[model samples]
Target: MKKKSIVSMLVAFYLAFGVLFSSVSAKIQSEQAFDNKIVKRLKVNNIYNHIEALSKEPRVAGTEAEWKAVQYIKRQFDSYGYESELQPFTFIEYKAPTKVSVNVNGDTVAAAPFTYTPNGDVNGELDYIGLGTPDDIKGKDLTNKIALIKRGEITFGEKVINAANAGAKAVIIFNHLSGELNGTLGNVDNRFVPTIAMTKEQGDILVEKLNSGDVLSASITIAGSVIEEKTSHNVIAKKDVTHKQKDTNQVIVIGAHYDFVPTSPGANDDASGTAVTLELARVLAKVPTDTEIHFITFGAEELGLIGSNKYVDSLTDVEIDRIVGMFQLDMVGSKDAGELVMFTVDGEKNLVTDLSAAAGVRTGTPLTYGQEGRSDHVPFYYAGIPAALFIHSPTEPWYHTPEDSLDKISKEKLLETAKIVGSAAYQIARPDTPALERAKVAPKEVDYEKMTGGLK
Candidate 1:
């Protein structure tokens, strides 16, 4: 009787293993089918071309080019057969005075406005104000002098404002280092002056020569500006509107910044990410899913993450809590990119990173994990939601520059990212009959030595 019982148990175990393997195999087949469709849609579509065109022109917020870019995005969602919007909001617009020039001992040098600088033009003796704080200029006869302030010690805007209020005719805030310092007043405000920020090297040279009692002379032309009533909008496309579990307005948001810095086309900076988000919306909208997917492309991301902040702030506690996940896709189409990694704020792991890593394993794609969130995910994460930035480490050189055009995009990289993210999203969004469960095993740690193929 004992021998018969052992044989029955062994047979039962074998049957269970066989059935389990078969079920997992069938599920894998379905996932692969979904991957195939997603990849195809990414390529041979205007998605890449759309990126090229947008990158061709500057999409700096509040600029005509940005508005054109907005229309282009609206057209894309329309083409994808989804409802879109240009959700608008009011923000301070820091304006650069039309012309800002500096003169040192009769030789005129080039300069640009510190955004939001007050309007005034005056010539005064040059005085080096250490960082140009109100305290620094308190007793100095800087009544009509150009204060050559250093970069560090405070916000560049604060320094400019301090000097202007202290009765300084003009301000020259130079960089404390070698590279040119691009400064802004940050946002629209009435306090400003005809101020300019220069490279540390340039400032050092100017200050050194002046300390030798060489009477220095400087002049500035200030043209401060503000848009009395200006607004920018964010577009959102939704999927799986009526999720099964409505207890909380739980949602998973995938987004990328659609605005670029001035002069650069911003292709890889964001066009790549924006394009992919669009493709995901296209594919996922057709497939059935339980989780709500909010496909968004943000405006003014370059302007201090305003769009994303607004979106998160608008959410009530119940809504914010329901935001189970947030994924930010920025600059994902460059070649020679480093290992794909998920980054959080303090290098702490979160749900998005863990789930994404597991999905990579199931799909045979590899991803590196890290905690370095500096994108749209920050606002959400601070709200206590799971968030991450999907980016390849050590981004390409052309990032945020004119060189970030279509030619720089790597089709292979885009397709692979789409596949991995699509699968990962689907696993959570639309599981099979039994419903996809998180892998029981902890994610395997990345092995750089083996991945690099050899020692350097």
Candidate 2:
């Protein structure tokens, strides 16, 4: 009887182990099957072609080129059998001054006017105010004087406004770094005085002279500055749940910026991202899914993420609550860049990174995540949505220059990014997968490196 009981226990142990192994094997197969559906349908040429078309010119926001790009994106989405919508928004566009001159004590000093600075010519005594904070100018007399300030502690706009409120006629803000300062006042403000930026070297010299009791009379002339209201757009394509009965009542956002700086063709700065978004929309058009997906190309992203901010703000409370994850692609195809990394606004791991990291391991390379907020993902993260930016770190040599053309794009990089993001997104959208509840869905924890420094 004792021998028979031992035999029965051995048999039960082997049976349980077999069942566990088979379950694990089946799970792996299921994930691969879904990934194959995305990878097999993704055409690199389609992505490359889209980039080639979009990068033919600089699609500066609020410009004719940007409008053309928006229309092209919409048409592509429509071709994929998704109903596309064009959401438009207006922004104040600042045209730089044709001439900006600053003469201090009969010596011509190098200066650049800040964006949104009104045209003005003022001649006044230069007063050195520390940082131009309200407290710094509290007990001082700055009436009709030019405030000489350093660039720190406060925004350039706020500095200018503080000085202006304190009866200053103009403002000159110098950089702490050893380069020419090119900055913006953020937006048009009636309180802003004539503001100009200078290098750290020049600013230091002025500060020393003022401290040494040398009266510096400066004349600042800014001409031909213009501010106008202009319109930009966001192209949105939606894929509703394939089976309404199995709906998870969740939404996923896949986004990229389409606008580029005036000097850059922006093939890699964002056209790579936008093209990938377009191709993904095409590939997933008919894929059966239980969650909704939104593929969006935002405008005015070059100008402080205006399009994305508007899109998020437009969402109703109900709509916002339904969004589970946002995947933002921003410079994924540059040949000269380093390994792929993900960035979150707060630098914490969330659903987007969790899903993508797992997908990355399955796709052959595990990804590292770092803290960054210079992309469209910032807006979504601020709205309490789990979002991340996908990009190659140590960015290419031509980040925002004219050299950022289509020729600099790498097909291999693009393909890798597309597979990871597509697989991750589908993991959430696939009907076979259980509905993901933020509090309940504990993704398999994977070991990954945490990057601290900003995206290089």
Best by TM-score: 2
User: Which regions of candidate 2 are displaced past 4 Å?
Assistant: 1-22, 139-141, 174-182, 198-216, 439-456
Q: Specify the poorest-scoring 10-residue window by lDDT in model 2.
A: 447-456
lDDT of 1 by residue, 263-325 (tens): 888888898888888888887777766667888888888878888898888878777756667
Models 1 onward score TM values of: 0.72, 0.85
Top candidate (lDDT): 2
